[model samples]
Target: MEISPDAIIILKWNGIHINATIVFTWAVMVILVFISWMATKNLTIGPKISRWQNFLEVIVGYMRQQVREITQQNPDPFIPFLGTLFLFISVSNLLDIIPGYQPPTGSLSTTSALAICVFFAIPIFGIAKKGIRDYFKHYLEPSIFMMPFNIIGDFSRTLALAVRLFGNVMSGTLIVAVLLLITPLFVPIVMQILGLLIGQIQAYIFTVLATVYIASATRIENKPNKIEQKEGSKENE
Candidate 1:
C-alpha cells in the first residue's frame, strides 16, 4: 500500500548514511535466527508436531528433497544452508505486506549479497570435498578451451540470481502499491496473495539453483584409466 523508503538513515560515528536496504536485511537476519532457534529447540521425529514445528518441518523437508533430487544423492550436508535460504527469502518477501515492513529481497543490495554468499560457498564446499586443485580444474569443464566460457558463465549465473530475485520481489511490491493506490478497500488483499505465491516460487527457484551449482561443483567426474597396454603385442607381435 505504502511505498517503502529506498534507504534508511543510520547513525554513524561521524555522520549518518541513509541505507534502508541494509537495515531491512539486518531485520530479516534477526528473524531468521529466531525462527531457526525455535525450530531446533522443538525438533522431534515423533508423530506429534507443534504448529510452529510443523510449519518448519514442511519447509525443511521440501528443501531437503529438492536438494537430494538435484544432486541425485544424499543432501544431509546442504540441508541447513539451503533450508535457511528458502525460509529467509520466503519470509523476507512476505514482510513487505505488513503495515510498516519491507521485503529485503526486493532490494538489490540484499539479493546480491545473498548471491555472493552462495558464490563463495560453492567454491568452498567444492574445495572441501574434492581438494583445491580439482575444484579449480572444474572451471575448465568440458574442455580446456571452454575454461574462459565456463568462468564467465559462472559469474553470469551468480549475477542472474541477484537480479532475478530483486526484480521479481520489487515488481510484486510495486504492483501491490499501485493497486492499493487505485483502490484502497480490498484489492490489495488479492495482490498480497499473488505476492506470496511469487515470493515462494522465487525462493524455491533460488535454492534449487544453488543446490544445482553446488552439486556440479562437488561431483566427481569419472576419469578414464590410463592403462597404456600394447595393443599390437596382443597377438605376440
Candidate 2:
C-alpha cells in the first residue's frame, strides 16, 4: 500500500496549520483527564472495591514496586510523577486496541512531547533538590573536562527515548494492520495478541528508563573529603 505522507489532517488558524498529531495529543489529554476523574471519584479503604478501582490499585502497586526496585530506595517521593507517567503512556499505547482508534504515542510528535517533558523535568527537579549550581555541576562529574560530552550525551538520551518509543509502537501497529489486510484469517488475531504483549512491555521499558534517568539526575554521589584525607595522613605521619 502506498500510504501518502499527507496521512494527517491539517487545520488552519491565522495561517498556522495544526496537524493531526496535535489533535490526537489533545484527544489523549482529554481521555486522561476523564480517566483521572473517574478513578478518583469514589475512594475508600473498604473490603468492597470496584473492579476498576482494584485494577488501578494493582497498576499503582506494581509501579511503586518497580520504582523502589530500580532505585533501591523508597519511591514514595517519586510515585506521583512516575506513576502518572507510566499510566498515561501505557494507556495511550493500548488505545490501538480500540477499533478506528490510533495510539497517540505511535507518532514521533507525541513521543517527543513526552520525552521533552522528561528532559525539562529532570533538570527542574534536580535543581530544585540540589540547587541550580550543584545540578549544573553534575555535568562536570569526575572531571571538568567531560562537561561538554556529558551534556551532549544526556540530551541524546532524551532523543533516544522519543525515537525508540515512536518506532516501536508505530512498527507494531503497521505490521499488525498489514497482516490483517493480507490475511483476515486466524493470523490477525494472533498478531493482535502479540502486539498487545509487545505494547505493554515497551511501555514498561520506556517508563523504567525514564525513571532511571530522573533518579540519576537527582542522585547524590559520594565525594572524597580532601580535608579529612589530609588530617588522616598527618595523624599517620
Candidate 3:
C-alpha cells in the first residue's frame, strides 16, 4: 500500500513535486468556501429563516458555545478558526465515503501541518492577549530550569497531535480498504460503518484538544497577576 499521499508524485523535476495532500487540501478549501457562500447568500434576521441559514446558525451556535465554555472569553475571535478546524476535519472524514476519494487527514504531512498551525497559534494568541514579554515568561514558570522541559513539552504535544490524528485516520482507511479486498459484502459494509464512526470521533477529539490548547494559552493572558496589579496601582498613585 502507498503509505502516504505525499508519496504519490503528481509532478517531478530536479527536486520538486506536487503531492495528493496539497491537491486534496485545496479541494477541501474550495468545497468549504463554496458551501459557506451558498449558505450565507440569503441570511436574514427576520422571524423566518432559510433552511441553510438555520442549519449554519445551529452549527455556529454550538461551536461558539464550546469555545466560550472552554476559554470563558468572548468566542468571536475563536469561532472562525475553531469552526473551520471542526468543519474541515469532520467533512474530510465523512467524505471518505465518496468513491475514489482519499481523505487528506489520513496523511501524516497533512496532520503535521494542522498540528503546526496549532503550535504557532498557541503563542500567537498568547502574545496577542498577554503581551510578548509575558507570553515568553510562561516558559520560565516555576523555575528557569524548567525552560527546557517547557520547550520539550511544546514539541512533544504537537508531535503527539499530528501522530494521533494521522494514525487513527490512516488506520481506519487502511482497514476499510483492506477489508474490501478480502471480506464479503456484509462484513466490509460493517467495517465501513465503523470507520465512519471512528472518523467522526477523531475529528471531535482533535477539535477539542485544539480548543483546550488555545484556551489555556489565552486564559493565562486573561488572568491578572496579583503582584503586577498591586505594583501598577502604586505607580498610578
TM-score of each: 0.82, 0.82, 0.89
The sequence of per-residue lDDT tens digits that candidate 1 reaches over residues 44-145 is: 789987888898778677777877876766899888878778878988887866876678788787889889999998998789889999999876656899
The CA root-mean-square deviation of candidate 1, after full C-alpha superposition on the true structure, stands at 10.2
Writing each residue's lDDT as its tens digit, candidate 3 over 49-138 gives 988889889999998888888678898987787788889998888888887678899999899998999899889887888889988898
Ranking by lDDT: 3, 1, 2
Model 2 lDDT at residue 19: 66
User: How much lDDT does each candidate structure score?
Assistant: 0.77, 0.74, 0.82
Backbone atom clashes (below 3 Å) for every candidate: 3, 0, 0
**Residue 50 in model 1: lDDT:** 82
> What's the lDDT of the predicted structure labeled candidate 2?
0.74
lDDT of 1: 0.77
Model 3 global lDDT (CA atoms, 0 to 1): 0.82
Q: How well is each residue in 39-58 modelled by candidate 2, as lDDT tens digits? A: 77897899998777788789
Q: Look at candidate 2 and give me any clashing residue pairs.
A: none
